[model samples]
Target chain A: MAEQDEDSLIGYDPLAWMHRSDFNQDSRKAEVGESEVDSSTELASSTETASNLEIDLDQAPADASEPYASQGERAVLVLEPVLNIQNVSVLHQHLMQMLSNFEAIDIDASGVTMIDTANLQLLLILKQTAIGLQKSISIDFPSDKFIEASELLGIAEMLEVDQAASGFF
Target chain B: MSARIVAVLNQKGGVGKTTTSVNLTHALAKLGKKITVIDFDPQSHLAVSLGSVDPQKSGIDKVLLEGVSLAEQSIPVRKNLNLVVAGPRLQEIEQLTDGGARRGDLLRRALLDGNRDEDFIFIDCPPSSGVLVANALFAADEILVPMTSDYLALQGLSHLVGTIKKFESALKRPYKFSLVMSRYIPTRRISKEVLSVIQKYFPGQILATAIRETALLAECPSFGKTIFEYRPGCRSARDFMALAEDFLQGRMM
Candidate 1:
């Protein structure tokens, strides 16, 4: 038994071991354990470095110097690409948040590709809120889907899209 | 059994669409059919005329927006007739016309799942060819077009028929279209002539019973009751009852 064990150990070739060492080294970073250090200063410093790296990478492009290229114009709050009852609460919260910033809320629904009853209700609430605030808010660029949906739901007059917005008091 | 959806539509305003919807619903209920009337009209005159409900308090707007169950929003007006009252949020419901699940079929889906044990469902469509009207058209298996005897009435009928045809083509489902003459004065020669024209153009589509011009029909809305409840002996009540019988029996011609 002892002789057999010695022979098996020797059969593990040294040349094969040398070849496998490079593969192990390549995986060393992935095998690292979490650091025990909890210092706020170190964490802050690391975060600052990461942010700086991000900014540096972002600024590398020559077009970054263009006025609207880096920061981008303040994105207009538009209807979500999809509108349904499942996410209606989220849309409502989003609309409320948008309304908090500007007295006059203009939603660009051009991006909305789909809608349901729940989303329709959100639009209604937004309109009611605007009415209560006595501010002018408008929904713009209604797609064919929007027009067809409005006609079916029987609230076409309520959507303050371009045609109707002109008459909004 | 699939729920029977009846849509009351008239593009011409003040042609008694609401009145017909509310009264027929009541009449149908009296004949032992469980009925749910969905007032898709933003104006919500049907809710007011039937239940004396204030449009603001109807809460239908929330149902449409929040996915509230129809049972929760529906108000029971009588033994067999229930109402899903219209809400003020109708002012903005149009904005939802874009993409969504059950976009055109929202009301239909709601009513099917509403579980009211109703055999018949009536949708009171708005005056215009808007989303509400589309919803009604999409939901209904049968459509009742109310008209008066006038030149514009004929024009309105043509427009409504065109709309129905479009809906049928889009949905790929056939609908039973019936004409109900309202404010019909039998003595007037023009009224008789127009009725004949309607009969000729729409053979077997006109109901035998026509609602005559009666002040009682107009007055009952103020009292928040159907002609049956308000004045059962009145001519309007008789006409509606006969119309209801004709409707249930499928004998309109």
Candidate 2:
């Protein structure tokens, strides 16, 4: 059964792996206080292995939620992961919690140095949900890399950023 | 002296909004006046054109979105000319207008706090009448509309003028406007007719100087240059310089 699951997830785009590698190199320096794997190599290897497992779609294990994810209604969630982890169940849960409470969500990623395909997909999913429910969701202060990633994906318009109010974050 | 805020706005894209902002700021700077150019457009083309700084690296979006101080993000473009670069993160700032308190005044407060040492501030408004433009109008003392010589340009001028009037009534402040003829071709009869019609409607609000249609203005940005820097003696550059001088001498009135 494990083999069947592994086989099903095998051809996951190799480009994703490349993105993960580039993201790790770019973001590893700022992942402090967010992940136990301090070294860039360790963070990359651990995330790759976790991604290979293709964890179930249900809630992520409590240990996985550690620093990148928080269960708060109005609190600002900071995702400072060093590498790109394929499953962003923790991030999705954070957005769902914000939706349930009808609270404005502000994601502060100023400390983030890199992001992978999983992180990008998580943002898209959150944005889509916010639009569908007509809820006010905002990605507070994203770093340059985060902005570049959004522009690359052609979703820069959806972010709804106001450059003037940036000083308050 | 009270700082003057002028917004270079035209709803229609490619109508010389950015060009006017960049050149006007430079022209004003040449007069020994301290000027700050705010690139309110998320596209960040103004920053690239004047400062040669990448918007992503400058963090102007942070100042607007996270309350980052303008002093921290303001990049010096040239002597007496400073730039507040816009980045992709501005998209988040636009969404803050969910029926909030003083949505239009947020930019006004930011500019007031940021512009301590400046004499004049020029805002390059985006090509839409969204909240960003509203914030700019709330902060500005005067609005300058740059229009090309076309029938569609007249449509844009009417809508923008109406919007400005509405803003003036709501804010209970006098909103002054001047329409500038841009990309004008001398031999075109339609251009002349459009100019006559605008003058009939706006009367004395039209500036005397018209920016002749030229390719130099469009090509300068790709080379990380302004027309003044690329070809100071060229007709386009000289015309813009003259316009800047006329503006300072209060010739627009």
Candidate 3:
């Protein structure tokens, strides 16, 4: 039951708040019931964790560590190898912002040298959100470190990574 | 495999909508197919007949309005049969969804949200065109329209058929419909005449076994029981039991 893994998710489940009508069309946003309440609550609980993540992104001065940057219609969310309590906020913001303007989300996991169960859950949630919004997401460039972390948890399939292409050992 | 979701419906009142839902599901359960009956009718007859549920506690409404899980809301009735009672408040939901898709597929999303292990899921819809009926159509893979033997029932029955067709085309998903001729008075010559007309219209769609008008069916619900529990040896019970067999036979057929 990924219940423990679900709890370790450093951010909110965007599905909890985003209703079917919210993504029906950008022009109209209808109030969804449970998804909205649940997502909002999880988002509220992760505020401190998210803020801490924002601070870490500010401290790291790497070109890839810009955390989030635009790529025309598709947005790139640069995740650190060790998401922990540090860079989850950056990922959450990008997920929440998916409904705003982005047609697709490209998760750049090339720098992700380390990841845990909580981080795996975050990736799953992002995939789920993309499906509900009728949007696309491509994690086509995960590093060897990311693949190793995913394999340790036996969730290579859950992340939808093509093993041969993904170098999944 | 998931449960086969079935909605028993008719636009007209007193067409054995609740009667068939209560008795047929119990009969199906008796045959060893896991069953759950959802009383979506605002009248709450299905709940009252099955017994042990608050008339105002619509289990589906809680799933829709209060974020209550479907499994949590169900109350066990007969062996292998669990019941979800309907409240008068359900009518309010129909009024709300008639205008738009703002809260559409509430039932579909809820029923499909988790693992529903029942072999058959029967929903008794309210007697009209509204959100409640729409929800039933959206969620149901099959529809059972229980109509009385008469020419007057033909138009309303046809309208309901058309509604099912429109839903299938619009949703791009197929839904099967079967007719159960209820309240059949065997001695009446008009009964046969109306049935002949129905046969011409529906052909193989009509169930061969008819629910004859009987005091047992009418009296059982008032006592909060179905035909099988009330009088298992009676003709009414046999008719429904045969119908249940018919349903089961259709499965492998």
Please provide TM-scores, in order, for all candidate models, with all chains considered together. 0.60, 0.59, 0.58
Top-scoring candidate (TM-score): 1
Q: Model 2, residue A127: what's the lDDT?
A: 71
Q: Which residue window of length 10 is worst by lDDT in model 2 chain B?
A: B162-171
Off by over 4 Å in 3: A1-169, B97-99, B251-253
Ordered by TM-score, highest first, the candidates read 1, 2, 3
Docking category of candidate 2:
incorrect
Q: What level of docking quality does candidate 1 show?
A: incorrect
TM-score of chain A of each: 0.50, 0.49, 0.51
Weakest 10 consecutive residues of candidate 3 chain A by summed lDDT? A22-31
Model 1, span A1-169: residue lDDT tens: 0021342212212112112222232223223332311110111122222110111112223553321113211113445567777667655655565455334444556555688877777787778886676433555446666756776888767874524211111
Separate clash counts for every candidate: 17, 30, 9
For all the predictions, what are the DockQ values? 0.01, 0.01, 0.01
Local accuracy of candidate 1 as per-residue lDDT tens digits, B23-132 = 88899999999988887888878888986576467455667677788789777889898888888886466555454425555666666674457798788888876566
